[model samples]
Target: MLAFERLGIRFGGNQAVQDVTGSLTPGKITAIIGPNGAGKTTFFNMLSGFYKPTSGVITLSGQPISGRPTHEVVARGVARTFQTTTLYKNLSALENAVLGHRVRTKAGLLDALLRSGRERHDESESLKAAHHALERVGLERKAHVTASLLSQEEQKRVSIASALATQPSILLLDEPAGGLNPEETARLMDLIRQLVGAGLTVALIEHKMNLVMGLADQVMVLHHGQLIAQGPPAEVSRNPAVITAYLGSHGGGGQHGQSAPAGGASV
Candidate 1:
């Protein structure tokens, strides 16, 4: 479980994120939705330790984790995948995932140089972990392939597999469906559901309203750096504030260039 209480962040004189508060339950998917510049990414960066929040606290499993270093936060059972794919083009998919397990390796410098018993054991364990992570993401067949040679969708999966290789209790995904086709998006939804079914908590920020509506158990809407709405999909869809926030910017009463079914409800 996680909680953000009255979270606030300012970039110079601009208050990018203003007093936002929410919580994420274990074994559930929570979606943070809003138009561009809603401060969703800023909230994520603060939670992930990329930026220290100007105010409030972020607690993971009841312990405050605000202002911790990114690496330290990751070691504390949190992992993240960016909007854009981040992988080693020269490395094989398996190698990239193995790198995620780097923090867990016990092989010392001398052991690595000499290929000692400990080094060999660590290597074998890391390999098995990497393979297992890839398998979880349906990328096992691409394990030995070079990352640069894979398609965009495949590359995205590899990025997720790498994050999973870290064995996180909570995963934060930014725009997982950003560039995927319909089929790919469906597959991604299935993967996310599977992860939640397996008891992993997921906090996702997605522009793809369809995916969010179909997958999120709880939806939180942010507008102008503030919490505009928070509830189940059905209630959120009927909210006037949400409609205005989505539709007002565009010419129509509640139509933002595209129609996003209310509440991140099922598509």
Candidate 2:
């Protein structure tokens, strides 16, 4: 599990994130929701080492990992997918997934140039892992398809599969369902649940209220770079600050009313 305390970062005079503190419980989905500029992705960037915190402590299990280089952070069992799908558009899905192994490979450019045995071995391992990753996302049948030719939903899965090929225990997703329709969203939900069911810990920043409310084991709310509320869906939905800041008037207000704010994802 990962835990942090009093975490914060700054850009000139802007406090992009401030005094945010939380943990990703093992085998559970933690959904982060808030209005724009709430620092949700900033929080993720800090945790994943894309950005280093100006203050606070981050520990995986019981060791410090804050500010570590991204490859080092990833080597420590954390990996992430971007809000946008970041596959190699010109490559086959399998080849794109194989790129995840680059961070973990020990063979260097010289070894590759010399055609060393280590390079071949690492490549074989990467290929095997990539195949397994595509299988995990149910893209084994389309492994050879060009990334640009795949559907948007498939591209999303391929992005996820690339992360899985890195073999991370903690997965940080930034809007995995951003553009999908209801049915596609539902299927994405099932895939998320399946990942958790198989023992991956998940944390995500998403604007889709229904996805967060229905799928998150715990929901954390942020506004203006600070955490305002965090708890189970119902409890967070009922918090007055959450309602006033991001949830709007009817967020979990009654049995018949929708808990979402105006414009399902604008919040």
Candidate 3:
């Protein structure tokens, strides 16, 4: 449901992403993998409207979405969670999740001041949605707790719930497993699989190779701001370029046609 065509981004004279092209279909997860400084996050920023692309087009379901304001992108059925967990520390978990719903309304000052039945109904619905989102991420019991009281993994789940609360058609996740333990990472992968199975399009930039290989339906490898390979995990793992760039130093052993387990592990 998300497609990029000849995408390029530059900062002054330096290009961080160049001629990138890919497609992520609905009900599927696409993983973007690359070594450090490969412009993976830069591509995500451009896609999320955080940075306008220097050249190219980003389309969602056939409509161009690139260069739109960030809020406008959210309004157009796109929502993303950052690599860092960004919850209001003092706020209750429920309150933090409900913030995602604020972008879904069309209320004005008068509506807030008057507190009409419509506003009340919307508010109630927002709470219900937020609660459901929290439950989806397995954080329902912590709804009334302060965001700061949770652990790092819990905070990441809260971030995902907040994004889901926005009801976006496409969810872009940046390194959702960055700081989690192995067990937590496995659970997160299961959650991601469940999300895509339920009809949401997910595109993620992740370094946790185990989760990516196990959960991603398609893999796109970027190196030096260009796509070096794109294919199934089995094929991408065996790709000469991908091995040399990210895996060669870590037990790749110059074997290009054998299965390689992710997460710096061997199969």
Candidate 4:
């Protein structure tokens, strides 16, 4: 599990995130939704160690993880995907996914240069894991495809597959549905649900209200860089402050409620 207490960050005089508190538990999905500039990504950056917090602490299980370097955080069972799908454009899908296993690799550069048994064995395992990750995202059949040749949705799923290959305990996804169409977003939602069913903890920052309300086990709404409401999807959808700040722009709670169909509703 991952927990944060009074977590915040500042850039010079700008308080991008302020005193937000929450937790993500095993086999559950936590959706963070907000308008533009709500500091959702800032919270994720701090949690994933891309940015050191200006206040408060983040912990995984019972130990502090805040302020650690990004690689250190990944090494400690936390991995994330960026809002932008990051991939080696020229690399095969399998190759890009294999990079995720670097955090778990034990073979040294020297071993690779010498083609030692250890390097060969490590590579075999990494490739196997990469294939498994690709399968999870339904991309195994395209493992040899170049990253640049994939469609937009495929690219996003590949980005997720690469992160999943890291064998992380907690996965932070920044805007996983940012640009996908309705059908693509539906597929992505099902993929995310499968991940939770497989016992991985997921926290995602998404502007797609429907996904948040339908897929998330818990929901957190952010505004002006702070949490205004957080709870189960139905409760959050009805919060007066949440409506005033964000959801009201879409509709005041009926279609955005937890019972709403995932494929319907654009806000």
User: Model 1: per-residue lDDT, tens digit, 1-267?
Assistant: 778999999988999999988888788899988877889989899888898999999998899999999877887888889998889999999999998876677788999999999999989988988999999999999999999999888898899998888888999999988889889999999999998888799999987777877889988998889999988766776778887777775536554354545643322
For candidate 4, lDDT tens digit of each residue in 30-149?
988776677889889999999999999999888999999998899888999999999999998999999998778899989999999999999999999999999999999999999999
Candidate 3 lDDT over residue span 1-267, tens digit each: 778999999999899999998888788889888877889999999888999998999998899999999988887878899988889999988999999887887766788899987788778888998999999899999999999999888899999999899888899999999889999998898888888787789999987777877888889988889998999887888887887776454554533333343445532
TM-scores for candidates 1 onward, in order: 0.91, 0.93, 0.91, 0.92
| Number of the top-ranking candidate, with TM-score as the measure | 2
Candidate 3 ranges with C-alpha deviation above 4 Å: 247-267
Candidate 1: which pairs clash?
213-264, 233-263
Scored by lDDT, model 1 comes in at: 0.86
Sorted by lDDT (best first), the order is: 2, 4, 1, 3
- How well does candidate 3 score on lDDT at residue 174? 94
Model 2 lowest lDDT segment of ten: 254-263
Task: For residue 83, give model 2's deviation from the true position in Å.
Answer: 1.1
Best by lDDT: 2
